[model samples]
Target chain A: MKNMYEILINALQADELIAQVTILNGSNVGEKLLLWPDGRKYGGLGSEKLEKQIIEKAKELFQRQETRKLEFELDEGRISIFIQVYPPSPRMIVVGAVHIAVPLTELGKTMGFRTIVVDARSAFATRERFPHVDEIIVKWPSEALEALHPDEGTYVAILSHDAKFDIPALQVPVQSKAKYVGVLASKHTYSILHEALRENGVSEALLGKVHTPIGIKKLGSRGPEGIAFSVMAEMIAEMRGVEIT
Target chain B: MRDVMENISNWREEGKQIVLATVVKAYGSALRPIGSKMAISSAGDISGSVSGGCVESAVYEEAQSVLANSEPRLVEYGIADETAWSVGLTCGGTIEVFLELLD
Candidate 1:
C-alpha cells in the first residue's frame, strides 16, 4: 500500500491541489481518500458510491479553495467528512524596493506568501536589501510584470510613490487576475494617477479594482514598518474574506 | 503535519509503535483550524498538536487504545461537552479528532 503521508507531502511540494477526505461518521470512520486534480486516488473511503459522491463534493470545494466539514444523510446513517484542500501559497509582487517595500516583503513571507520584489534600479533591488525575499527582479514595471504573470493568487503592490514608475506599474495589474492591486500614494497623487490611467485607456471598472492609499483604513501608520504592517493586515483580511473598516 | 511526518518517520526507524491524531472538524471559533495533526509514540513521545493546549492528554489516552486495537476512532471535545468536567476544552468551540494506529 502506498503511504498517504508520502503522497500528501509530494502533492504539497509540487504545489498541486490535493484534497484530503476523512470520514468522521458512518461505519468507515477515519478512512481517508486523497484526491489529486489529475484524478489520482491515494486511498479509498470504503465504498465506490460514497467515494464518487465525496470526490464530486471535493472538486466543488477545491474550486472555492476552502476547507469544510460536511454532513450527509446516507441510508447507513448520517456521515460527516472533513474536506481539506491544500493549494499553493499566494504570491506577493512588491513593485518597489523602497523603505516600505522592505518591510512589506518581510511581512509577506511571515504571512506565508511567496514574496517577490521588483525594481528597475539594480542598486535598490539587491540581495543585501531584501535577504528574505523569494525573488528580486531588476527590471522596469512592464517587463517585470510581463515575466511575473499575475494570477488569481497574486497580490500586487506599487510602492514607488512616483508617477513615472507608478503609472506604468499600475496598468497591467489593474486588469490581471491578481486578487489585490494596491498603490501607495496620497489623496492628491491618487486623483492625478486615476485621471492619467483613465486617459491612458484603462476602463473605469478596471481602475475601480485598484486599491489606492493602500492598507486598512484608519490604521494611522506613521512609519514605513507600520504602513507595511497595515498593508499585510489588509491582505490577510481580503484573503480570509473579512471586511475591514 | 510536516512535524508529525518527520517524527513519525524517526520513530518508525527506531521500531517504535505509533498512533496518529488529526483534527477533522472544528466548529465555532476553534484556535487551531481543521487538518491539524499530532503523532503519539508508544513511549509517550508527542509531536504536533490538534488543539493548542486543551484536550491533548485526552487524545494521548485515546491513542493508547487505538494502538492496542489497531482500530481508528473519532473523539470530540468542547467546553460544554459531556466530558466537560473530566477533559473539557476551555476553547469554547467543538473539535472532532480522528485517531488511527500508524505503526
Candidate 2:
C-alpha cells in the first residue's frame, strides 16, 4: 500500500491518465481523492456520497480534458472540489524524412510533443538529420504506425508527397484513432491520392477526415519551414478543438 | 505540476520542508491556465511557475506562511486600479491559488 503522493508520482511517471480531486471548502478542506479513468481510486474525501459525486464530476472533466472546480451542495454544507486531470504527453508522428520533417520535428518537440519520424530510406532517416526527434523508425510508414499504436493523443503527418509512400502512409492513420491525420499534397496531387485511396476501398467518411493539402488556409508562404509552421498551426488548432474558418 | 514533480521529489528526499501552490481558478485572460503549480522549499528555492512573472512573489510569501503554520490557504489575486503598485496580474486577470505544505 502506497501513500496518495507516491501513487500520484508513480502514475505521472508511468504516463498514465489520472485525476486529482481536492476539497477546497467545507470541513473537508485539503482532503484529496485520486481517480483513474478506469474507476481505480486512491484516498477519499470523507463522505461516500461526496466521493461518488466527485468521481462522476471527474469523469466529465476527463472527457473535457481540463481542470475545473465545481461547487456541490451537500446535506451538511456546500463543498467545492477542484478536479485536475493529468493526461499523457501528446505525440507527433511524421511519416517522412523530407526537408519539412526536420523543422516539423523541431517544432513538435518545442511544442512539447514526443516526435517520431518514420521513413523507409535509411540514409534520410538518420540520427544526423533528426537529432532532436524522440524516435526515428527506418521502416515503411504503415508498419511503423501499426507498431506505434497512435491513439487519441497522437497526431500524424504524412509528408511523403510521393504517391507510393504517401498512399501507404495515409492508409494507417486515416483509419486509426489518431486525433489529427494530415497529408502534404498539392490540390492536384491530393485529388489523385484521394481517388487512389477510394479505389483501395477506403470509406468516404474516413477519407473526409484526412486533411489534404495539409496546413491552415491562407498561409500564403512557401518553403519547408513555412509549410511546417502552417501544419503545426493546423495541428494546434485541432488539438485545441478550435474551428479554423 | 508535471514540470515540477521531479524537483519536488528531490526536495522531499533531501528532507526539506516544501510548500506547493496551485492555481485552482482563473478568470479573464489568465496567463497561466488552471492547475498550474509552483513549488517552494523552506530554503527559498522555487520550481515551476503559476503565472507569467506576476503574483509569484506574493505566492512565495504565502507559501512561507503555510510552511511555518502547516495550514492550507487559498488566496486570490486580481488587478486593482487603486493598488496599481501591488502584487497582482498585469494581464488583467484574476487567479485563485491554493497553498499547502507538502508532506
Candidate 3:
C-alpha cells in the first residue's frame, strides 16, 4: 500500500496524465484506482476485478483526458465513482486577429489556454495588436493550420468572417478535436457559409461543431464588440460544459 | 499551485515559518487534481489547495507537524484509511501528500 503511494507520487511528479477515481459511496468506499499508461493496473476500488474493469474504462476516458463521475451497479450494492481525468490544457487557434481577437486572446490567457492568431495580411496580424497572443503566423489557413498541431482542447474561431479567409481556414481546424469551433458571422451569413462547407464535403456531424454566430444568444444590440463577447462566452460555455439553460 | 510557488519561496526567505502540502496523488474524484499545492505558514497565510474544502484541515495538521519537526514527510489519506474522511477528501478519493517545511 505504501509502495503504491510512492509510485503514484512519482508518476504525478513526472506530469503523467492519470485519472483518479474515488468510490464515494460503497463498501470499498475509499479504495483507489491506479491505472497506468500501458493499461496495466494496481490498487482496487473494491476487488481486483472491479479495479481492473474500472481501470479499463478509466483508460478509455484518459486518452481524451475527460472528466466524469461514474455510477456502477454491483451485486452487493449500488456503487458510484467520481472520476477526474487529467489531460493537458487545449490550444485555442484564432483565425484573423481583429479588434475582437483582443478580448478573446486576453480571456484565453487568463484561463490557462494557449492561444494562436493568424492572418494572411501582415498589417492586421502584428504583435502590437496581440501582445500576449502566441504564434502570430502571417499566412493562409492551409499554411498556418498545417504548421499547428491540434489536439482535443484545440479551439478554432473563424473570426475572419470573410469567405475567402474563413473558408480556407475551416479546412485545417474543423477535423481536429477542438471541442469549440466558433465562426463569427450573422445568421444569414452562416447559412450561406455553412452551405458552402456542406458543398465542400464537410460532413453534417463535423459541420455541426461549427458554431456560426458563436457565443451566447445576444441579450441587447449586437455589433462587432458584442459579437466578440458573445463568441467568447460561447467558447467558455463549451469549454466548461456550461449551457445557457 | 504553480502560482503559489514563488510566493511561498518569498515568504520562506523572509523567515516566516512555512510548510507546503501538495496533492502528490489522488484517486478517483479529487477536489483538486494531483500536483495541486497549498502553502500554509505559521502566520496562518495560505495559498493553493489539495482538495476543495475537504482535505485542508488534515493537511493543515500534517503541515504543522512538518513545521514543528522541520522535516519532510508524506501523508496518505483516503476513505479507506480508517480516518473515514474526517476533515479530509470527503469526496471519497484518496490523496497521497508530500509535505515540505521551510524556515
Per-model DockQ against the true two-chain complex: 0.51, 0.70, 0.09
**Model 3 chain B, TM?**
0.84
Give each model a TM-score: 0.80, 0.85, 0.60
Q: Judged by DockQ, which candidate is best?
A: 2
Q: Where is model 2 chain A poorest over a 10-residue stretch in terms of lDDT?
A: A213-222
Q: Which RMSD values do the candidates have, in order?
A: 3.7, 3.0, 8.4
Over the full model, what C-alpha lDDT does candidate 1 score relative to the true structure? 0.85
Candidate 3 lDDT over residue span A1-245, tens digit each: 45554455556544466666656545555455667557766666656666766777787787776666567777787776656565655577888878888888877776766788888999999988889985688999657887885666688888887888887678667777767788888898888877887888888889887876677775553666676667767777887788664
Cα error of candidate 2 at position B27, Å = 1.7
Q: Mark the regions of model 2 whose C-alpha exceeds 4 Å error after superposition.
A: A1-3, A74-76, A122-134, A220-223, B9-16, B80-85
* Residue pairs clashing, model 1: none
Best by TM-score: 2
> In terms of TM-score, which candidate is stronger, 1 or 2?
2
Residue A172 in candidate 2, Cα distance off native in Å: 1.4
Task: Order the numbered candidates by TM-score, best leading.
Answer: 2, 1, 3
Off by over 4 Å in 1: A24-30, A70-80, A126-128, B1-20, B38-49, B60-71, B82-88, B101-103
Instruction: Please state the error at residue A209 of candidate 1 in Å.
Output: 2.7
Clashing pairs in 2: none
Candidate maximizing lDDT: 2
